[model samples]
Target: MKKLINNPNHVVEEMIDGYAKAHPQHVRVLSENSRSIVTARETADGKVGVLIGGGSGHEPAFMGYVGPGMADGVAVGNIFASPPPDPILEATKAIDKGAGVIYVYGNYAGDLMNFGMAAELAELEADIQVGKVIVTDDVASAPKEEKEKRRGIAGEFFVTKVAGAASEKGYSLEDVVRVANKANDQTRTMGVGLSPCSLPQTGKPSFELEENEMEIGLGHHGEPGIEKGDLQPADQVADRLVHDILADMPLGEGEKVAVLVNGLGSTTKMELYIVFRRVEQILNEKGIQIHRSFVGDYSTSLEMGGCSVTLIKLDDELTEFVDAPADCPMYVQR
Candidate 1:
């Protein structure tokens, strides 16, 4: 596979170094744990510390969200792999002030196991209180009755944002988790993959697709999607994704919502906006008011060519948190 990376084995380390250097004002790498990034901004002693973690390759995800008004610390793992308990615990320790710490991450097996162990380890060794909120918002991953079984996709962004905002508001650890869980429960996401992503180590695509074929509802790790079919227009794809999500969590007329149209990887901003245009059209036709919309590569899967659309049903509380100021390198809001 053609990639502009150094040794595959060192890609994650090099990336961390580069990111730390580039965004010194926002985050810093823990000297003892390179995979653990702590926000540069100081938080109040009584404020809950927000900690997020997950596998790498989804840049600006677990790490990029670390900063003021967002994640206080992030434990980054290898590409598509869970961070070990050591780094996870290190991240938790780095952010903990005295109140408590909350772990926010996608609902994946490896992530759950590692982060869960880290939480236990922290309590046993450091006497730190910890809580967790798993994001499971991919509507296409499971049936409506089985949302807890669905995988977390771009919807993780909304959950993380709400968690950070809640913590920044000085909410207690339990309240922060409660806010994040509410966001995750209201959020729904669906994606379409036009091409597969290649791993640096293997130098091979995770999956294959024909020039004219696409996989709808594909997971970030090349997990099975709803179906593969001939590629269609961007509007058609957007329609299907929006339809499924809305059906899963229907929005009332005149209801406020937040929209995120995220690129998986190689998908261009031009293409993402095209998808967003259709998304906006659909939401308008449905009388669902979009309070805010974000379009870009917020989350990615190496160089996969695809995009996911996320909608979070917004209430006054959620809107307030979502609008809270944030100053992360990759994601900043005022």
Candidate 2:
């Protein structure tokens, strides 16, 4: 509630405006369409244009990845809300190259509905080919039988990175989708909620938990979690996250992985790193080397105080694309 925002209704617009101004060399925000497209300066003609879309609030997500080596366009919505079909369709049209386009977004109901509609609309009119990869990595979101039913967390980053890179490397639309789906299949995540986020419009906390309690596997919308319990130490929390995520996607001690310890807003980098140290040590004991690692706010739930850990077992091709340079205001590790 103590956010430094201008107004709830205008936050998304204002933020997008500022973002476009500060990173002109990389991207341009389409205010009318509620989307942002990467500068054609970096993406070559006849190459597949990669597009990703989702709600706002999760910074460095649907938008920040649009750059030289990442997404070509992104559709934005209100905080914690899905972008409309118009913007999604516009994004597809804006980014489509002669090769085609791939639409990669997290697995969420609203996003599914909106993006699906947009894709249908685009294919009906334009000569644009589009495919979608739904990121379902949060183990806490559903049981094994319903993994696809789970919501996406921070694992969207790896999906976008690999998928975008595949397209940038001149992969076909189907090929880009194949690699993106592979990235989704090879990833899993788990997280805990220390505090809840407030919807910009409502100006009220989405949910409330006691100071001594934490919710496991909570959705970005602050939905009820898999379980609630008394808060534990950071290491213990990390153990819960690691064991749960790794159990589903078992990591043999000698294997390798690219880890992402992400903050869901309000959770400082200090806490994220505290969790990462334990995660690193645990994976190291298992003989798993980190091919690439990121620790900071990636996808956030507005100002929720929580974190999610993502582990993607890396392969040669994936490693190469992940290492490709990406320049955005939020994730500028080129």
Candidate 3:
């Protein structure tokens, strides 16, 4: 359990603190709640305020997306843990303008509970109207017929990107929610785990795997997946992942889509590129058109080693929103 930190309990605080300082020009901790962060730019008048929140650990996620044309605010929790209602409320309040607020987050039990409570609190006390779009895009977490039961993973990037673009377009809260929900529906993701990550506090791997073994369809928080098997060649691994996602939602000929090859944590660019190489080849063979491609460590699970692939089916409307300009620490679109 090797980690660079003064105290395991203080990792979240220190990380957030350092993030605020490092990107002061683009973000700041809410004065009312340290756990909540808001875009440095003042909330745009009459624009739907976008608030994305969830557990901490997955950096460049819930908070890193805070900036113009992205999330207006974010409520952060402990590593792989949901934040309480208070900070969620603070985040909602910080972003809400007369146009109302939209909450974009993964479809997790804790997030649903806490965000639901915060929405009720905001309506009750501040008279702020709130809308929500919960992302459930991991295909391996559930059967195709049970997508709603799947857990959100790297696909969250596409969901947030579309939602933020809609908000920037001055869509009403209802419309923004609609757009984000549509993105979630069009998105599908699948991940494989080559190694496990240790919680800062636990100082131990959350799960164990034998040497030269891999877990397909593993969740970022170590959720069980389809199966575990001996580590295979990169192309074989990529083929299986791409095949599962395509089977769940067939892309068909000439359909355009966005591709996101994300590193879970310690996976290197070289490995990710190797995976993407196969992904591109597979898509080309299927006659699916790649509208855009993104590759990097957009979402991570502490120091875990593995990666996930996300694809978002796109139409003219979705394509425009995805290409819209956004400025954030982790995501930038010009």
lDDT of each: 0.91, 0.83, 0.91
Q: Locate the minimum summed-lDDT window of 10 residues in model 2.
A: 34-43
- C-alpha RMSD by candidate, in order: 0.9, 1.5, 0.8
Q: Where is model 3 poorest over a 10-residue stretch in terms of lDDT?
A: 60-69
How many clashes (backbone atoms < 3 Å, residues ≥3 apart in a chain or on different chains) does model 1 have?
0
lDDT per residue, candidate 3, 175-270, as tens digits? 999989999999999999999999989888968899999999999899888899999999999999999989999989999999999999899999
Each candidate's clash count: 0, 1, 0
Query: How do the residues 57-152 of candidate 1 rate in per-residue lDDT, one tens digit apiece?
Result: 998787888888888999999999999999989988888899899998888999899989999999999989999999999888889998889898
- How many backbone clashes are present in model 3? 0
Query: Candidate 2 regions off by >4 Å?
Result: 40-42
Off by over 4 Å in 1: none
TM-score of 1: 0.98
Ranking by lDDT: 1, 3, 2
| Superposition error at 67 for model 2 (Å) | 0.4
